[model samples]
Target: MPDTRSGDRQMAPPRPRPKRSDAEDNRARIIDIARTAFAAAPDATLQSIAKAAGVGQGTMYRHFPSREALLLAVYRTDVEALVEVAPSLLDAHEPLDALRLWFGRLAAYGRIKHGASQAMEAATRADLKSQYYPPVVAALDQLLTACKDAGHLRPGADADEVLLLVSFLWRAESGPDWQERTDRMLGIVVDGLRTAPRA
Candidate 1:
């Protein structure tokens, strides 16, 4: 004795969202572990890295395809991470401060990616830089413009010129004394970029 109208009133349960593929998760884990290992020692053995990443040789191979491929992926990931943070950086601080902070993060990113990035072929490296530099420069340009408009920087301040000076930041990633050297250099550059009286 079910009600005759019960069928009309019934509704289907909602469908569940699709889960992320396990292969993608495993690939991400491998890249993360490889980054740490490569940072600690640029020449760290792949066997050890695989072990540290908790993935089998076959799995790591399947994900990365090759060591060079893995290195390139890590480089791309680092650059993209820096690029992604630009707006947030500007939002969380004053214009000039945000510009300075972004460069500080830039120096750190150079260090993080330097080991493997330096291994890329000259032409390929140049291409990647060309592709990546525009977005970062665009963000920096906006920040610099804001600083000038706010009287925190000289009128006609050139973000491109300032960015050129930071090109050497990648080299600061090298050597045991890099921390002290990079801090002092970045400070000097930032100070020089400030308007008289931070007007």
Candidate 2:
């Protein structure tokens, strides 16, 4: 009688550790290097970027399977940072001041993203926008709501409209001293938002 017992079943392997901090650090470094390399030239090679990042080509490939993957990673990282800052900003500063500071950071992020935009294909751009838009819009909406309730902004001041209005700054033409122009633009926006009449 060659009867097999229930113990004969093959057990699944145990899972790996929850977080790969080393992998995460490597991925972040790779993204940072890729952002610089791609910004200089969208067609920048993965070999050069990996070398610049002090990683093997295989490691870069593991973190980002494609050129588009690396580019999108950089953009998404920027968006997530901007979105994540909202709550902390609102907590640390006065409502109006928080909004101003958040938008100022957004202006800076926009400069980085503008350079990244050259690397994206149409489909990738659309996908990236879809993934990030709602969260960012919600963040801005929440900040606007807080500002209104705190008497920082007018009752009827609009978040989406404000998003559109300030988007021009995101696409602003880069020049030798574009940061000056960007700062001036943000100041004008903050002043306008502060002055809108309450209902």
Candidate 3:
């Protein structure tokens, strides 16, 4: 029986620890580089992004296997930023005012993301659905629920429908008349929602 208990169990192999912060930082750098390239030229290719980012093309490939993957990454970053800041909007001077404020930001996000999406499509990727849609939609649903609960929005109005309308309108081309036209459209929408039957 001498040392029998100790011999019974074999030693387990060491597990690899994840480099959470380093991986996060590298991801951040890649996204920042991609964003800078896109801002300068929305059609920047992977090679261009690699050159701008000071990383090798292989590195970029490692981080984002395909152009669509990069596009999805960028879109997710923007949505994360939007979703992260949403809570502060809840403390606005008024609930409707907060809704309007967030909607404006959402419109701006729509414009930026649309530009990125066009680039991704041109990159020859087939998948059109964003990888970030589910989370973003869920976050917006929360906001919509808050407004409905407060009786500031139409009870039966679908948040998804409203989001689609805003996204569609946000794509209207920019011009001297565009801002005013958009404002009028948004105003009409708000009015319609506010006046609709609560139940």
Models 1 onward score TM values of 0.78, 0.84, 0.68
- State which candidate has the highest TM-score: 2
Instruction: Give the TM-score (vs. native) of candidate 1.
Output: 0.78
1-199, model 2: which lDDT tens digit per residue?
7546778866779988776788888999998888777666767777889999999989989988888778777888889998999999999998888898889888877777776666676317366677888889988988998998887777777877988889976588778888788878778777778756334
Choose the strongest candidate by lDDT: 2
TM-score of 3: 0.68
Candidate with better lDDT, 1 vs 2: 2
Among residues 3 or more apart in sequence or in different chains, the pairs in candidate 3 whose N, CA or C atoms overlap within 3 Å are: none
- Candidate 3, 72: how far from true, in Å? 2.3
Which residue window of length 10 is worst by lDDT in model 3? 123-132
Q: How many backbone clashes does every candidate have?
A: 0, 0, 0
Please, what are the lDDT tens digits per residue for candidate 3 over residues 1-199? 5465767867789899886886667678888777656644677788887777778877788889976678667766877887765567776546676667777767666656655656756765544345556666766677777788888887876777777767765367655685577677777777777846334
Report lDDT per candidate.
0.76, 0.81, 0.70
Residue pairs with clashing backbones, model 1: none
State the displacement of the C-alpha of residue 13, model 2, in Å, after optimal TM-score superposition: 6.0
**lDDT for model 3:** 0.70
